[model samples]
Target chain A: MAQIIQIDRPVETSKSKNVIRKTMSICPECMKILPADVFERDGKVFMSKVCPTHGEVEELYFGSYEMYTKFSTYWTDGKGALSPNVPIDKCACPTNCGLCSNHLSHTGLGNMIITNRCDLTCWYCFFYVKKGLEGAYVYEPTMEQMTAMIRTLRAQRPVPGNSMQITGGEPTLREDLVDIVKMIKREGINHVQLNTNGINIALNTDLALKLREAGVSNLYLSFDGVTPKTNPKNHWEAPYTIENCRKAHLGVVLVPTVIKSINDHELGDILRFAQTNIDTVRAISYQPVSLTGRMSKKEREKYRITIPDCIERIEEQTNGEVTKDDWFPVPTCSPVTHFIEAFTKKPQYELSIHFACGAGTYVFEDADTKKLVPITKFVDIRGLLEFLEEKTEELESGANRYVIAARFLSKINGFVNKEKQPKGLSLAKLLTSALLKHDYSSVGQFHLNSMFLGMMHFQDKYNQDEERLQRCDIHYVTPDMRIIPFCSFNVIPEWYRDRIQQKYGMPIEEWEKKTGEKLEQRLYRGTLRRNIAKHEMNQMACATQAAHIEPITGT
Target chain B: MKYVYEPVKGLERTCIRNISISSSSDTVRLDEPVDFTVKLSVAGGIRDAFTSDLWEKAWDAWDKTFRMTYNIGIKKVVAGPITKDVIKSQKFVRRATFYWSRSPELNPDYSKKIWVMVVLEGREPVHPKSVDEAKTTLFDVKKTFRVMGSDLGKGKHALKAFGKASWGRHIFGEKGNSQSVSKEITITCK
Candidate 1:
């Protein structure tokens, strides 16, 4: 028999209401339960306890108190749903758009949309750029906006000063590109640059001259193949021919999006074009499409190619003079492929190449010099967007004239001597000398680990072939700009990128304050000591083992 | 070997002091210290040649001691100039054999034999505060015996003889354990 007690109920009269809110704290490391009211300050949660081994576990915070328990369990098992209660309100499109802070941290490269319109729509475009996908007016910018963006860029300086690359369906399609360049120069962002298809420069020599006059230093030109026949359409979307590129008088790096069936056999022709356009054309970068975008999985598979195969083809065509082993991985994009110059016969030395999947970073060894070098640069597609938004004020200036002039002259020079141009030092060779000189033994190996960590960010599996990507520290970079305690091998889904950008939407100012490490300084300051310490600790831990001894007398 | 003794009530103090040895004491031999003395003597002239090994034994023992203290290992000690300082008198003396008196006797078959009696004596007493300059002295009785009608040089052989003696803790002078019984006798042809 159960005893039920019923107290006197209020006679349906409502006067006041009393509400009780319960809170609890959690341990991030072990997920042990703790009461909430222990320590609370500035809307942050904390708890302290002495573990059995006398390990003093310190404070921890729960961004959303209601979902703390759920998060604890989720992190432990890598399962469970996100904290829906603590909804992200900053960014407009959270889950839908992939520019969240978390995603940005994982994707070290910044995004720069040169224009809304594109001349050719590749089926495997990663940006979801389709026929009707264009946003806003193509090439729409006021001098004020450009200037303002430039100013913001200067103010929100990132660590390890990165390059700002303007890219679109074709940045040249935008008439104001020259003006934009001028504004970038006027704002004194000497590193301002663009990624483009050289078509406009080839058709309009005057436009090229103007762009060169604006003082644009380098050009990441989309020159996918040597011949139009390499494409299925037998088509070349870029308006400029190899001749026009020479005339541009700019340091043009030939960016080729290698398609497996179409241009896989044209390695020789591509290298030949590069050599012919020597001084004006710096390096030929072969990029195999990641097959992300509006294309179907089947279609992507049909067209997707790899960088290794290209390296092999180059070796075979050049009779081993240019081989795959000679190529060195780019610090930022090591997993995708390597970069090689015309001169290196399996070069064994270099400056330094780094991979930055946010702060999860690594550098690489030089194939020519076999030296360990620091990672000097990285790519941040989202940061580029932030740059465009911030530096809108300096979009127009007289300095733009020099950029256009340089391009025009370089292109004209090439056009005149298209057949028998004298070969010169390649940009890859120069950059190798400048950025990658191995300063210490075993540094190359550490850099390789850092690179591997970064590659792990993009894909779940380790790409051993990517020398740098296989060796980088993967978990160092965090969404709030704080580096992880060490590189943790926790898997981060690509979808998280969209969520982070949408939720935190951390501005550059906030990033600097939170990280306590100036972003721009990372470019010059090497983190070799930290890297070496980590390696030493890893080695010691690996070698330590238990031992037993017994007395010979058996006493 | 054990000896049996029975006593009556009045003879209680007269008990047997049995002395059992694994072998005869006089039969024992020492390999070193050839110039040494023993309580036993040769039974005949021919016997003296067989057991007269004292000079060799003494020389060997002296050499061993000298080697242990010097002339070996990393640090070698070479004998310096033979100065009088090295002839210091021994603070105490020990002997393996007791002092003995010997008398020669003629025998048949052209052989000779000797009768000997062992004796021991204490050294002369001296004042406590005498200026004792350390010096050694040897008995000069060499002229008492002759072999093949030729005189042996002054007691050199006797002086060279050293007894197979054991080191002692006390009685640091010439007055201890000087008398004992002789096991045999010796004779030299003249």
Candidate 2:
């Protein structure tokens, strides 16, 4: 329960599950709280929960028990928010959503839905606005309301949130998007990333430059695959968006919503595509599709891919260039927070999310081999982590700060083999400032030259684990001034997202009448995709010189 | 002809490598200053014999070490307006050396039992993902040395009295991992 996340259920047969920890989960059908068991079978980890009505349900919690245990080694808790909106002591997790005291991590990134409107409607996305649906209301917050939400984020205790992700059906759909970016920056939010389908940016080439000038850090552009078959949603226009962003000097993070038997096969291709455009592309955050709504067990199995499953395919597809051994879970970063907190004597930003939530590693382009070398290969990350932990302990035990600094300078090189690290990396130089000076400029510098591959499988109804909920670092800020974790905010939208948005939103007709504009006016015509087709580079992959693959997998 | 090492009685736990106390000179004059030296050597120190790589034992092994720490010291006196003698070693060590001078106030009979001891402390690290760095002794060791004075006896007797104790010898502490090893050295106070 203390970062171990004892997923419990009544053990059945001795051979079935080697039960490890016991925790609580919710029934997929009725949302009834039930006992769950987390166990290991054949090197894979699984969670089985029992509901009186739904009987016993089993699901794969993690694909690799080896990886699970490895990631759990760095399970360090975070300092909970000093000010809780709901300050109840005894814990009841997802039910207690709005900044509850039981919440483990402070907000790492606050997502604000600038508008629910988008240029294209993809079937997989559930958070966007659908025209024909009942209660199809537009939930675009006014500038004032957004300011208030940013205030809520900045108001977080210990370490106030400094980063914001403006997401929506497509944040670019809002005409005031540039102003919104400016407002977010003005509100003391240092980092602003606009989450969009990139259709608007592709159509309006100058928009990227404008947004960059407005202080937006980058575009969290949705580009699922290298081929149109795997990524039809803006596959045609995405290239133009990246080109424009490059010209504007704005960085981009390619986001692929990977679905098994669908886009999963194209993960390595997506990575290669990112590498091909490594100059402009910052990172690729591959999210395994979280299947929501009612679906048969057979159907769910087709699309379900755990973090390990994705990593396995990545290794196979990359021909073992990137392996499973390279990945470390989200909470593995907690030691840096502990070290920085100890070194700087201040509450620093920590990604103390649940170990099962996400896993990632940095990949550097080796100058000699020209192949992607995972940070783990060149750096002794585990040894460095243990050393940091020991140093933190020494500092806490009244060791002189200068002496610790001197010891840090003397011993840091022992862990990092200079010959193995990528040429021109200056790894120690970049790390020293980030840790010693507490300056994150070095981290940003490292990001510019490297590609960070991350996997964040957001929870849905079928695989909802409350333990993941308690440690959720990615959060959403409501106009009501409550900061809610991402899982509870989107997974159970009826309780949080819908409830809050509906209260603040207006019906489509009413909104149109007030704005003196038709709702369909915001819908972007496929002009960019059609125009890109007529160009000579139409046959090639977006942002690359390689040829594009035709649609084979069904849309 | 053969040296056999029996680990912590029945358990195959890590104990001591070969550690002993030695004086600068076996025989020394009363007015001459003397120094003490502690020599230690071991195979694998206190470490996690259990594989830390195994998921089953990883969590417990993170901070846990089957390994122990040792405090090696030569009990001595600090000369001052109010002179005081140390009863216990203040710090831990594997091999240590100290320089001592005759105190101005203390009479020639100032010496009692000039000895060195090893005080072991703490346990070792992870079940299997990690293991201890291989060394001779996991814990710091203690040893006591004897220099025969004019009142009692004299001359180069600095021989390890512990029978058949040499390289490949193992020492186990029955109490708190603390052991007292005494070495007798020949010194003259003529």
Angstrom error at residue B172, model 1: 74
- Model 1 chain B: weakest 10-residue lDDT segment is B64-73
Instruction: List where candidate 2 sits over 4 angstroms from the true fold.
Output: A1-15, A533-540, A543-555, B1-190
Candidate 1, residue B64: lDDT: 7
Local accuracy of candidate 2 as per-residue lDDT tens digits, A371-435: 89999887888778767866775675457889999999998888777888887787887888889
RMSD to the hidden true structure, all candidates = 40.2, 15.4
Best by TM-score: 2
Task: Considering the two chains of model 1, state its CAPRI-style docking category.
Answer: incorrect
Lowest lDDT 10-residue stretch of candidate 1 chain A: A546-555
- TM-scores of all models? 0.35, 0.74
lDDT by residue for model 2 (B83-116), tens: 2233223333221101011111111222211111
Candidate 1 Cα outliers beyond 4 Å, as residue runs: A1-111, A126-143, A157-162, A232-241, A293-301, A332-555, B1-190
Candidate 1: residue A473 lDDT (0-100): 25
**Model 2, chain A: how large is the TM-score?**
0.94
Residue-wise C-alpha lDDT for candidate 1, range B1-190, written one tens digit per residue:
1122211122112111111111112221232111112221112221122111321232222110000000000111123311122111122221121100011111112111211111111212111111111001111001111122122212221111111111211111111111112122221212
